[model samples]
Target: MKKTSIETYYELFYRWQRSGLSKAAFADREGISKVSFYAWCKKFETKPDSQDASTGFTRIELAESASQSAVAKISYPSGISVEL
Candidate 1:
């Protein structure tokens, strides 16, 4: 089996949590072995969103803008943006 990057798995975990799909279904859709998916999930389940620097991931908390009229937006690294 080819080695997969932790970053990729982290992205997958984030998506899967929001996807509303069963782990089995997600694994099937992503073409990954269910066993491996389950294993990775279990391994990382205890990790906090704000990981140590070694993982190259950090969760940030931003205070709400003072202006009520300001639009809230979410931007993805993939160049996708959503404004609320």
Candidate 2:
């Protein structure tokens, strides 16, 4: 793998997360190895959103999907730029 700076990693992380590209697909596209991608995914899997109970997505699926959504995207606080 090519050496990447912190900024690049974070940018890659943010992009990979927000792009909704599954780990394998994103890793391939970004020239990142699957192991690294999975590592990042596991490391940052804490963004699950709370879902409405009435959505009928099933409790388990809702939880899983919420967790996946959280992992697949991220929101930064105002004034913070991924370019930094």
Candidate 3:
């Protein structure tokens, strides 16, 4: 077994994601064990939080509400004089 580093695990994970390869296929191509691939995913994968839905966002759905525009436009009288 080879000594694994945090850098190595992250590198493999990112490569797999970028390649769009299946976990098993990536592990096989990388000359790593299947268990290692799963382990790396467990350690590096972004965990989904159910609580996000309560805040109007969900981990399963990566979206946030756009900023609301509620302020009304300002109107000034022509009699007003201002110096810049």
Clashes of each: 0, 1, 0
Best by lDDT: 1
Q: Residue 83 of candidate 3: its Cα lDDT? A: 33
The TM-score measured for candidate 1 stands at: 0.59
lDDT, model 2, position 16 = 85
C-alpha RMSD by candidate, in order: 11.3, 16.2, 15.6
Model 2 spans with C-alpha error above 4 angstroms: 46-84
Would you list the rank order by lDDT, best first? 1, 3, 2
Would you list the rank order by TM-score, best first?
A: 1, 3, 2
lDDT of 3 by residue, 16-60 (tens): 989988999999999988997898788666545352322444343
TM-score of predicted model 2?
A: 0.44
Judging by TM-score, tell me the better candidate of 1 and 2. Answer: 1
TM-score of each: 0.59, 0.44, 0.52
- With a 3 Å backbone cut-off (N, CA, C), the pairs that clash in candidate 2 are 17-72
Q: Any idea how many clashes model 2 has?
A: 1
What's model 1's lDDT at 38?
A: 92
